[model samples]
Target: MRATFHLKTLTVAIAAFSVASAASAAGLDRSGQDVTAFLQDGLYAEAVYTYIDGDVSGHDNAYIGPDKKAYEQGKKIDDIAESYDFFRYGVKADINDTFSVGILYDEPFGAAADYSGDNNFVARGDLDASVNAISGGKASSAADAGLKIGQLTAGATQAGAAAANFAAQAQTATTPQAAAGFAEQAQAAQTQAQTLAGQAQSLGAAVAAARAEAATTGEGTNVEVRTESVTGILGMKLGENKNFQVYGGPVMQQVQADVALRGIAYGPATGYTTHISSDQDYGWLAGVSYSKPEIALLAALTYRSEIDHSLNIDETYPLVAALGGDPVQGNKIDITTPKSVNFDFQTGVNQTTLATAKVRWVPWTDFAIVPPLYNEVSKRSTGDDKGLPLVSYDEDQWLVELGLAKRLSPALAVTGTVGWDSGAGDPVTSLGPIEGYYSAGLGAKYNLTENWAVSAGGKYLWFGDAQGQIPTKTIVSDFDSNDGYALGVKVSYQAK
Candidate 1:
């Protein structure tokens, strides 16, 4: 039974992640570019354009009992958003022969949102009954036991006082029948107290047993979840030699998030959505790069600071209206995306060959979502404080990329890359699309003249499947997804 409740909770977390995906895909990591250095020294007074497409899907299953009488069937949720574009135009100005500075404006963060309202959806009766039975049974048992114990103690004290009064009356009364009647009443009161006391003990024991069973059941199910983040960046560079440059600037970010049970449904139907939206947040990044133009070796190191945000989350449950379920309102949640360190290295193997590698580390262990806020909101809406349990998460990841670029001629070059990323799985929140990736692309530079050039390229990415464990049940499902494709064009004119 505990496993059943946990499965429901896992479903909630996964649903939250799905809703947040749109926001995360658009934020600071927009277009999967990581192209900061690519835009450096080579261009002055130039325009660059880009486009991307993406597709994602998943299924959920929830069980309510061992007999399979109470269960919710799995369902599919698909998403497709494309034609999203990013643009930038900037100039690189050389100062003297040893210094230069460039300013750029680009759309760094954005995403599209869509979820089907019907089809392949199921909300089982046993599922809702199981959830209510466990949660309600526990609460009801506790309240009943408390009230019964209080009443029993009060009755025992009253009976003892009445016995003393009857003893006093016995000494002064002339009629034996009257004294006997008082004794009989006192005995009846004592009997009632004992019965109530016994009932309270039984209820207390049942509550403890039910709670213990729930705890044991919670550890079996697996869950898949995601978060949302959108960011825009404007960067400026200062340095000389084009080989050594320092860049720093402000980043604008927006986030949206939600949580729901993966395989569970709310009312007489399948799943409902519950989540929160964060207000816009502001943050910054600083980095330095070094290139050996004479040797063909280029390396860059950067630090992206963490952003703290307060999200306004709403709780929705269809069962509440149909089955008179508990009322819940929207509340605020505080969350923070971790800081990161990135290293990129590229070298020219020959006049026609260039190789590049990159590594990025994010401190995911430092973040978590607090569930008490949900309880506060629930209480305010329902006049009861039966709060939802909190969920814990942490993630650490490593990424490696290898690419080769060959110059077809003085005015054109083609490049292709393959990468590997291994990190935490779907069970852990904050585990973005970095799961596993395979990619390849080609690019070209056209020299319009000795001082002017134009470049264009396109790439397709294929991402591997991401899966998570449901807390207590052996039930597992796929959080399957596909790759994204992007196209880019750039024009640059150098100063003599």
Candidate 2:
């Protein structure tokens, strides 16, 4: 009975840790590369599904321009993230005591959000000429100030024509008093023309300045990221007791994303949307594992290399072309996903209990997405020759999880976990608002038969307070008093 309980606790902790560990990681981390599932002893297969629900709300939020002033005020941006689901599957087989192979399918990274709500932050621009921006320009809320500026020019032209006609009548006057009156009228009309011309020049300058400033202000965005990957693994056992194993293989990944921007703060990005897709990107993973059956100790360290992709991207923004900006833009971009390292270990504390811990590091600071044309416009407008990224990370991330598992019966096991993430940076982009999280989880595993078992787990995450910033490093929004949770279930089967 004692041995059976220890085995049950260890097995259940390994099975449930995948979902619990991922619930607190950084960036679009979904599966946490749960290679442990692929390292099972024999012919093993498992499928797991996870659902995450998050709610974010904040106040006193506004987009600050490069001039260090509020460019626009925003209402509460709430319910930005809806519920999302993820699925993972893996199968492993042991050809012999010293050889094993496996394959896994999972979504390693992803992000989703819908900004359609009562706030104008994410809504399409009306391009109203009556609206004024903080930078002092007509139609400042609109990306294309050309239409309004054109109207002003046309009105000035009409005034100039009338003034010329009055001067001609003055030259043909029959009486000195009438001629003097006509000349005065022509002079007033000419003065008015000069005034209008001056106004037009000032308007043009103001509009240009506003456009430049707007490029540096943050805006509301709707972004979705989808990733699918297949990893093939081969493992070899070594040492006299076959206690050490090494594994590595090829990985193929597919990535896609759709991003849309809006709000007065976005300027040229307003009504801009793009679709990016990649079919195949190759990478590799290598790992070493050590196991001691007597003490129920298993330790593994894995490294996943970054994958580079040249992707086809479709860009669209009607206002951009209308405003003399490029709408039909570059078709391809080179992007690379960040690399990561994972170290996981578990040990038997006693006959009935086990302890587990995992630590993950991802060099997110090395990650960035910069569309070509967008970068060009940003460079010209912000006077930053290097340009800015559409999305990026300022710092690396670390996630740590510790847990304990115990078996109450031969068929039932329970585990509890606490997790923490270091977050990629402070004042992250509005696209991914939360900085980091602290999480707690509980899980239970039940065996229906000798070869079949199921486990369910739930985790609650407390998000850290964070501010959203633009390229100018001005605060545009605040995210706080936010929380989220995830629920997952896994079913596993072993061939007898």
Candidate with best lDDT: 2
lDDT of 2: 0.73
Stretches of model 2 off by over 4 angstroms after superposition = 1-15, 63-74, 124-131, 134-220, 322-325
Error of 1 at 241 (Å): 7.6
Cα lDDT of model 2 by residue, 1-496, tens digit? 4443345345544446665455643667766777888666679999989888888666424543344434354677776775788889999999898989999998888888766554544543333421353233434544445565676677778778888988899999999988888888888888887767655544554454344334423445688988888999999999999999999999999989988766544444455678897668999999999988766788999999999999998877544554576677658988888788999888888876888888998888998888776676566446668898888878888988998888778778888999888887877766777788999999988888878989889999998877766554556667787899989998998763
Clashes of 2: 0
Residue 357 C-alpha lDDT in model 2: 89
Clashes of each: 40, 0
TM per candidate: 0.57, 0.81
Q: What is the lDDT of residue 338 in candidate 2?
A: 77
Residue 36 of model 2 has an lDDT of 81
* Model 1, CA-based lDDT: 0.47
